[model samples]
Target chain A: MNKQLLWLPFAAFIILGLILYSGIGKDPTKLDSRLIGKAIPAFSKSLLLSDQTITEKDIKGPALINVFASWCPACYSEHPYLMELSAKEKVVIYGLNYKDDKQDALKFIDRLGNPYNMIIFDNNGRLGIDLGVYGAPETFVVDKSNTIVYRHVGEVNERVWTNIILPKMLGTEGQ
Target chain B: MKKLLVTFFILLVILPQTAFSVISVYQFDDPAKEARFNQLVNELRCPKCQNNNLADSNSELSIDLKDIIYEKVQAGESDEQILVYLKDRYGDFISYNPPVKPSTWLLWYGPFVFLLIGGFFLYRFQSSHRQDTQDQQNDEQQANSMLEQWAKEAKDQETK
Candidate 1:
């Protein structure tokens, strides 16, 4: 019995080691959204490329609301993928221009080609705060009913679209 | 040499203290509101920085969060309301003091449970050790008495 008891600490150490090992190489910055399955928060903000205003109602249908900024380098990196998605018409994509200078944002859109159907200008990141956005480029998938189904913190790439997002949208559609 | 040492100490400590005191300044209508803002920021975690709280982090996200906290404070929102608003967006991890819930039970109780289990094991081991020593002493005493008895018996036999 004493010999068996001696193994308890070893067992505990192994269990803790396994737990800590599982967390290794995982992105610590990616936080799960508390707003998943909830409706988008109410807000009306001006369009970045147009004179029109974009609101929560505009977020309806199977769509992607990507938070981006002219100042964020990651947004530039993900711009081409967004353009490809836009060209394919797989889903409607809206943009939330987070805390970017208007002239810089306009120049960025002109230089990189606009992928957003309607871009919402969040000058002070008020709406970004409402959406729980910490940094760009964060992406959200809203279902037809305007409910946010998935939120990705980093840049949306092909891997994320095919593996994480497409299946989620398909599963939602099947339901 | 002493004067030089004092000057070096002042340069290393006092001068750096003023230089590194880059705490962001914000205008508050009332001192109480400023105090509340300070407390709230310190209690909230910076989502971007991960390691630092809002007050200690100089990240852009932390600055934005601090600004939001200030706005809410200025608007006369209660601390609880501000926390709720942030938690709604950032999840429960944003708050340093997470709420007591089923998911957070392990976080709140794991250390105490570990300590309790450790203490129990320590107590059991010590008691068993003490019992083993007592048994060894008893055995020694019995052997010594047995040897003495044998010696007494031998002496009696020789006397007879």
Candidate 2:
């Protein structure tokens, strides 16, 4: 009994060490959105390129709202994948220009071909706060019913589109 | 020289407090609202910085959250409503004090449970240790009495 008791602390320590070890090197920044399965927040913002205002009602059918900025390097990295997805895939992509200068954002879209169908200018990040966007390059997969199905916090690449986004979109359709 | 040292110590301690007060510059109509804003910011976790609270973090996201909190406070929203708004958007991760739910019950009670178990084991170990010492002392006393009795019997035999 004493020998078993002596091993108890060591067992607990080993279990704790294993748990901590498993968490090592894992990305802590990728937070799960609470907005999943919830309706997209209501917001009225203007298009980035034009003066036309867009609202939550404008976001109909299955679509992708990609939060991007001229200042965000990760957005640039994901831009090519977005362009490819827009051209090939049937996914409708909207851009939310998060807290960026208008001229700089326009220049960025000009330099890198605009893949977004309707880009919303969220100058004060009012929409962003509602979307719970902490950083740039976060993508949300909104279904036909306007309910947000999936949210990816980092740069969305081809692999992410194929694996995570596409699966969720398919799952949403089946439902 | 002693007076100069004391003055220098006072300056060293007090000057930084004034300088650090620059971070909180938003004015409030009501002092109670201002206090609530301060408390909310301190309690809310900065989504960008991760480790720092909104009050301590100077990140852009933290600033935006602070602004939101200020707006809510000015709008006469209760502290609970404001927190719920944030949690609805950012999830429970935004608040430093998470709500007690089934999933978070372990986090809330795990340490206390461990402490109780540890205390029980420690008490048992100490009592057993004390009993061992007492038993050894009793054996020593018995041996000492037996030695005395043997010596007395030897003396009696010698006398006879």
Candidate 3:
């Protein structure tokens, strides 16, 4: 019985170690990767588009979802990439405006030049949290099946286009 | 009436002294210093909580750290000195943006390494366990069939 009691504590310690090990070092963005190759999460939000109300359903198609916030400096840095992406009709690029004041986001768009087919406002970051986003300027590529195929955290730069997207276009992954 | 007057006098005198002492410790004035302090607090980590920064943290340690910063700044310490002192005391965990260095390679890369090692072990362990279980089940099935065959031969001999 004493030996059993000793083993009890050892078992508990192993469980604790396993729990910590499993949780440690996981990037919140990796959740996006898990969502990749799976159907995109439901998108239902209202955002300002060309002085009119726009909803996610209004833009019904496979889209590249980019989450951005006006207050995030990183979003400003990635504006050029968004512009280049939006210019392309190969994939519809939609924006999830994450946790920003409406007026400030509008001002940011005006200065940066709007580069979204439609913008969906996630005012309180509820949707962002659900998507396991740590911070702003994350990009996701959805295939024709509406499955999220790619997720890029932080800034999406020239290297991302060269390394990530071009290969997808050519029907291959960089591995 | 005399007792009441004496009590009132004692209360007023003691309370004001205590309040004055408390306020003197946390003088939240000087707009410039206040703004810089706020910015630093927001950038500092609570250490106790995963998601909370010092500015937003309500932990007692965080509050004490803030007060320490306030005291040092009021004593005319430079912002850099305060940052250095805090970093020295708490290690890089004090800062939200921990500096990347050779010493900090573990802090930065530890998680990815852990994940990779864990995944490798999990894959190996599961596959080995699966193979072992398959072998055990096959052995059990074979034993059961052999026992049944022996029982059938004994019954046939009894019938003859």
Candidate 4:
């Protein structure tokens, strides 16, 4: 009986170890609502469209702040979605050219046909890092208060628009 | 051979501390001192394995801190005293097992408490299994004794 009691903890420990091991490689869901309900980070860059300096104040009213780069394949995937959003014109959209060569970003804008009111080039990516952006094609929906209400981390699609954006614009989903 | 075995065990305990940058529990000879070392390690976070318990981590910082803990224990400081010193320097984030303050009680006790409850169920299951086997053995023994009595009666009847 004493021996069984002694072994119990060890056996229990092994069972716990198996449970923990099964959980390896599974990423815990993260709530990245840090920038949410906070003022948008200040941004200013040379425009990829008109080759003129553009500042965040230029599109201050109500806008979608889309982070994209020429080198990112996901940006290309999101191109059509951006064009569709532009066609709606219900909400103005601005693109922040994150960590790209100026010439390539300009060329990308030309090929995609600019859907943005104006594009801001963040070549060194300082502003992008400040916005907590890790990769390209991230979009944030900002209110008139300058507080970011929504953040999408991956490629934008019709599903994202119909589900997340339209409901947000209609004020049925989030602030 | 016994002498060699003793030496081998000693080396096995001491070699890892000398070889890699892992904090170990062998530095303190006194139980009180060893407890202090454990307390210090538990508080310090392993920077490389961000989410792991420092007591379980073999990271470089953990090793260095373990050495320091060993030294402090030898110097006769209590576990609480050493922890106070570390907290002064590194703040609360240094400890993987943060204290159950208003801010961190949920974080500290949540997972471990769940694990303990799970362990309790496992213990009950193992004990119940052992009890069932013992009961089966008892039943078999009683059946064998009844069969022996029947055999004896038959023999007696034949003799009569």
Candidate 5:
């Protein structure tokens, strides 16, 4: 029993080492959203460059709420994929013009080719806070009931569309 | 002239401490509210920066969060309400103080369990060490009594 007990410390060290080692290559920046499986927060903001008031009711489901800003470089990187998703894939994408001015946002859309069905202007980023947005190029997949199923931070690429987003989009469509 | 320049540089460093050129400065008429605001910002972590709290983080998200906190405090919302609001948006990761839950039970109790194990080992070692010393002392006592008995017998023999 004493001999067996002597191995306990070594066993503990090994267990701890294994646990820490598993976390080595894992990205700490990727955080799961607390808002997942919950309905999108209600807000009455204006559409981008328009006087029309937009709300949670206005947002169509089986769609994406993409938070983007003109100043964010990652948004520029993910622009082509969003265009393809919108034009070819026929996926409904709503733009959230986060903390960007009307003129710059218009120019940005013009340059990138507008991929959004309709853009919601979040001048003060109040709506972005309501949606729990921390950075630009974040996308949330909304189900038919307007429940947010998944949220992806950073840029959305072809791999993300194929693996992460499409399944959620199709899953939400029948619901 | 060198002494004057040194004093000027010293004044330059000291003067900025009195006047902050920060963006998140909110004008609060109530000192209590201001204190609560300051406390909340320090306690709340910046979701973008990950490491820095809302008070110190210069990230855009941190600035926006600070603005929301200021509004919430100004609107006479309680600290708990403000915490709930932020927690709803950012999850428990926003607060430094994690809630007591099953998921975190290991985090809270693991150290105490290890401490108990260490304490048990130390106590066992102490008791065993005492036993060793006790046996040695008993042996010494037995030898001393034997020597005393021999000395008494020798004296008795001489006397007789």
Candidate 6:
């Protein structure tokens, strides 16, 4: 019985080693969104296209909010996929231009075809703080109620759309 | 000697330029508010730069957040209210001090549990070790007494 007890520490050490091993390749930056199942944060800001002020009330959902910056390299990397989703798949995408120069952002859109249905310029990042946005190249899927259902950080490619964003946005149609 | 002088000159010029850090210049009317602003930023973690606090990170988001926090501190908002507001948006992960929840229960209590388990094993080992020593000593005493009894019997038989 006492000899068996000697193996207990070794068993515990092995269990701990196995538990820590599972964390090896996981991305630390992928944080779970607290905004999920909640209505979009209230904001009143100006639209990029028009002089009129826009607010949370102006947003209709079952759409995608793609946060991007002209300076972020990943935003450019995901632009082609975003364009495909918008132009071909007919996904309604709202652009949240995060803390970027307006002129450079406009030039980027002009250069690579605007994939956004409407652009909300957040130069001061007031809305971004309210939304808990970490950085650019993050996407949020809002349902018809304007409730954020899913959020994907990094880039939105074909796999991400098919697996997470699409099913989250339209339920059965994604499958 | 000329090459050494040129290298020294380059280091003097470039090192100083590289050492120049961009710091937040938001001026506060009250010294208390300024202190609070400093404390708040230092406590809040920068989301974009995962390892850095808002005070240390130069990321644009961190700068904007520091500005927002400065404004709030200046507006006479308490530290608790500001933290709550941030927690609501950024989740508990934003704070260096995570709250006690089901998920975080292990993190908060794991060390204590590990210590307890170690103490338990130590206690068990020590007691079992003591028992083994006592048992061996008792066996030796019994063997010694038996040998003495046998010697007495032999002497008694010779005397008879």
Best-matching candidate per DockQ: 2
Report the lDDT tens digits of candidate 1 across residue range A1-175. 3788878889999999998999999988889999899999999898987788868987766888999999999999999999999898557898999999999999999999988888999998889989999989999988878889999888899999999988888777777
Tell me the TM-score of each prediction against the true structure. 0.89, 0.94, 0.43, 0.51, 0.85, 0.84
Native-referenced DockQ of model 4: 0.03
Local error of candidate 4 at residue A37 (angstroms): 0.7
Model 2 segments more than 4 A misplaced: A21-26
DockQ comparison, 3 vs 5, better candidate: 5
lDDT against the true structure, per candidate, is: 0.89, 0.91, 0.72, 0.73, 0.90, 0.87
- Model 3 per-residue lDDT at B29: 67
Two-way lDDT contest, 4 vs 6, winner: 6
User: If both were scored by lDDT, which would come out higher, candidate 2 or candidate 6?
Assistant: 2
Cα-based RMSD of the predictions, in order? 2.7, 1.8, 21.9, 12.4, 4.2, 6.0
The clash numbers for all candidates, in the given order, read 0, 0, 0, 1, 0, 0
What is the full ranking by TM-score, best candidate first? 2, 1, 5, 6, 4, 3
* Candidate 6 fraction of reference contacts recovered: 0.72
* Per-residue lDDT over A11-112 for candidate 2, one digit per residue giving the tens place of the 0 to 100 score: 999999998999999889888898998998988989988899989999875889999999999999999999999998967999999999999999999999
Model 1 DockQ, alpha carbons vs. true complex: 0.68
lDDT of 6 by residue, A1-175 (tens): 3677778779989998998999999999888888988999999988776777888988888889999989999999899999999989998999999888889888889898899988999988889888889878889988888888888998999998898787787772343
User: How many clashes does the backbone of model 6 have?
Assistant: 0
lDDT of 5 by residue, B1-160 (tens): 9999999999999878766545437999999999899999999999987689888898888888888899999999999999999999888889998998998888889899989989999998799899999999999999999999999999999999
Report the lDDT tens digits of candidate 1 across residue range B90-121: 98879899898998889899999989998998
Chain B: TM-scores of all predictions: 0.82, 0.91, 0.47, 0.43, 0.76, 0.72
- The CA lDDT at A54 in model 1 is 69
Off by over 4 Å in 4: A1-31, A50-52, A172-175, B1-107, B118-160
Residue B104 shift from truth in candidate 5, angstroms:
1.4
Judge the docking of candidate 4 as incorrect, acceptable, medium or high.
Answer: incorrect
